[model samples]
Target: MNPIQQFVRWEAEKPEAIFLQQPLAGVWKKWTYRQAGQEIRSMATALAERGLPPRSRVGILSKNCAHWIMADLAIWMAGHISVPLYPTFTGNTIAQILEHSETKILFVGKLDTWEDQKAGIPTGVACIGFSTYLKTPFPAWEDLVTTHPPLKEFASWTADELATLKYTSGTTGNPKGVMLNFGAFQFVMKEGLNAIDVKPGDNNRLFSYLPLSHVAERSLVEMTALYSASTIYFSESLETFGANLAEAQPTIFLAVPRIWAKFREKILEAMPQPKLDKLLKIPLVNLLVKRAIKKKLGLAKCKWVISGAAPVAPELLRWFQKLDIIIRDTYGMTENLAFSHINLNKVKIGTVGHVWPGIQWRLSEQGELQMKHPGLMMGYYKDEALTNTVLTNDGYLKTGDKGEVDREGFFTITGRIKDQFKTDKGKFVDPTPIEMQLLQNPDIDQACVVGMGIPQPIALINLSAAGKSKSKDAIRDSIAQTLEHVNPSLESYEKLEAAVIMQRDWTVENGMLTPSMKLKRNELEKANLEKYPVWYKMKTAVVWE
Candidate 1:
């Protein structure tokens, strides 16, 4: 069955169970499965009455909320494909996605910064603001629900019908819309629910903080609610994230690796060496410490804590372990609806989880990981050339990530094929694993290693808040010693020549990070080429900041 069918079933099974909990104006508001279903049906009737053609694109621009999911379901129920637009995307990017997908209806949420760009939306298309807090001159969201009765005479839907058209986070180039069918989404949701061991009617509370525009958060998260009947809470704002977490007390938690690192840093920063030592020394105090840590992270009640979107540091995993939190690292992409592999039972510290159930994986001679899954996208929307390049004749999707499966069938992602660089001797060097290791040091916030045409790999790192307070020489010494602990397993060529600490972070606005938070290596090299001489030639680690 497709996502909506499952959602419909859940509504029937648990009508009074809260499906969505939105934190608005410092208060938590709930929408039950029945209420959600009714709202979606009403909205669907309104859209159908407005004459949205079958398979017509219905785009949604917002963060994670009840309205976002409601609009998504309403579009699907109306026999239309839902296209989610990133809240942080530029007007040009949003316009490109809308035009590329030929979207005719848009549901805009509360975005104060995007008010001016609303005029850039296609002239003939319809746009509505869903949240009352939004001061836009656009029509209200309540109008959609109040205007029409539930569309009982709905058109038939098939597994082959297009369900969602998700655009990639434009990093390497222009974002392409990923066209997913009903079969693709159902397959992903099924496999994902199995891997995560989500039981229907289970008391799994999820906090919806990640942007729903991304398929990772949309499919794996929102769809799971249908399967698990979990209560999803939305965050008020970035500033209120911590407060929201404490309030949500979620049982299922998912976040990007950078956020996990920040959480670790927050705990360490709060209780430094002496205090930590004292806390650990007393057994009772240690128990209280662990509970306090969990409470602070809003993960005190978390039964399933999953981290993805980027490689998580093994050290961060151990830190979570100390607090009795089991963190499972998963690997997937937008093209596959983000359910490729999940490491849950057999936790591989340095690797992503085993290949997702019902998914087939193979590595090419060049070690590029390729996969075939029922959930894989049909093709890039209206881009046959790009589709042919990615989807092979055998139906295996080129993942671009270089990986290896161990004898036990556990998969270890080495690095991106595009990320691997050649040294002076023409030997390829993979730095992701090493970079992931360095990020675990608690003193290093972020690290990117570059060695193109150099004799050996060199690294540029951003120090953690604690490391920022240290003397340059002291920080350099600590990093060198940390490297010494991790370098024995590395090959001579893969070893670092020197490490330089960068003063600033590589952010999206600065063109150093992608929208998904992956480092833009080419951008970094271009921006820092002039400063390379001090590190590459010195043969010694130095902190530039």
Candidate 2:
């Protein structure tokens, strides 16, 4: 069944059970299943009354909140396709996506940069803003809900009917909309639950903080919660994320690599790694220390802690494993509904575990991983030519990631085929592995290895919060030590000549990071291409840019 149907079933099964918990002004607000259903139905009626054509594209521009999910449901119930825009998108990007998707109505809610983004909304398109988050000039959601009655005749969707347009975080060019059907959602939800073996129950709790615009959060958190009849808690802001997560104590938790790094830094700040190591060596103290650490991180009750969106360092995973927190690394993309391979019970340290059932995968001559799955997107929206380039004639989705499969079928993504660059010496450098190594150093928060025309590759790095707190000499020494440790393991050409500390952090607002926290390599290169030569020629092992 589709997610809306699942929601309907739960609303009928347990009307009073809390389905969503949203925080505003440090106060927690709740929505029972019945209450949530009423709001969604009212909004659907409002949309239907607008006289839009069937399957019209409706956009949701907001951070993760209860209303974001409700808006998505309302769009579906109104016989419209949901188009989610990243809350971090700039005005230009917002305009591009809205125009490209032909969004009929936009739901503006809970945004920090709405002022900067409002100019992108076309005058012709109508808007409805969440009253709690923003006081927009447009019609308020509360007003619409109060004026419109619950939609008596909800739109029914076939399995193959279009559901949503999930736009990719554009690393190279304009973001392309990935067209997903109701069947894709159903397939992933069923197979994902089966793989994780998490049962549907009221006790299942989920903390939604990640960008629900992304497929990983949409599929795993939003859809999973709907499918399982679980309660979802929303973070109020970045400042309250820790407290909110701790309170929720979700049964299933997922975070990107950057978040995991921040968590590690937080832990190490309280108790230095050296001291923590000494304490953990004690048999009696180890369990207590691990429990305390997990509790502080709000993952004490997590049945499955997953790390995805980008490749995580094995060293980072190993560090967490010391505290008895085993992070399962997963691999997937927007095209596949983020359902491909996941490390479940028996996780290989560096590998994203075996492929899920019903997925067929093979390697191309270029070592690119290709897979055919039921959860694959219908295609990129209104871009059939580009879609044809990725989806093979025989139906396999070209993953664009180069990977290796071990004897046991565990998959390790080596690098993105498109991300490789050639040096002046004509040697190809795969930056992913080198970047992964650099990230192992607690001092470095983000690293990008770049040398398109230089003799040897050099690393551009931003210091972690811990690293920033250290003296310049101390940070340099740490970076020098990391380079010394990582270079010998690489081929001579692949070895980084020097590490250049960035002047500023790479953030989504700056266009250096995707909303998912993956590095925008092309953007980084563009901003620092000319400096590559100067950085490479620096006499010192570490250069502060």
lDDT of each: 0.82, 0.91
Give model 2 RMSD, 1 decimal.
1.1
Question: What is the C-alpha lDDT profile of model 2 across 1-545, one tens digit per residue?
Answer: 99989999998998998899998888889999999999999999999999999999999999999999999999999899999999999888989999999998999999999899999998688999998888988898989998999997889999998899999997888899999999999998888888777676637888899999999999889998899989889999999999888888898899998899989888888999789989999998999999998998899999889888988888899999988888999988999999889887698988999898889999999899999988999999898999999999999999999989999989988999999999999999999988988888888888999988799999999998999999999998999999999999999999889999999999998989999998888899889999999988876799989
Off by over 4 Å in 2: none
Off by over 4 Å in 1: 115-120, 453-455, 483-489, 530-535, 538-540, 543-545
Q: What does candidate 1 score on TM?
A: 0.94
TM-score, candidate number 2: 0.98
Candidate 2: 10-residue stretch with minimal lDDT: 194-203
Candidate 1 lDDT tens digits, 1-545: 77777788888888998899888888888899999888899988888877766888989988777898888888888888889987777777778888888999899885646765675588777887885547556677787688779877555688877788889886577888888888887787777777667889677788887888877787657878766788888888888999999998988888988888778767878887678768877979899988988898898888778888899888788777777888999999988878788887878788887887898888899999888988889999888999999999999999899888888888889888888888887888888888977786878888998887568888899887778888877887899987787677789888877778886878765768766787878788888766665568776655464
Top candidate by lDDT: 2
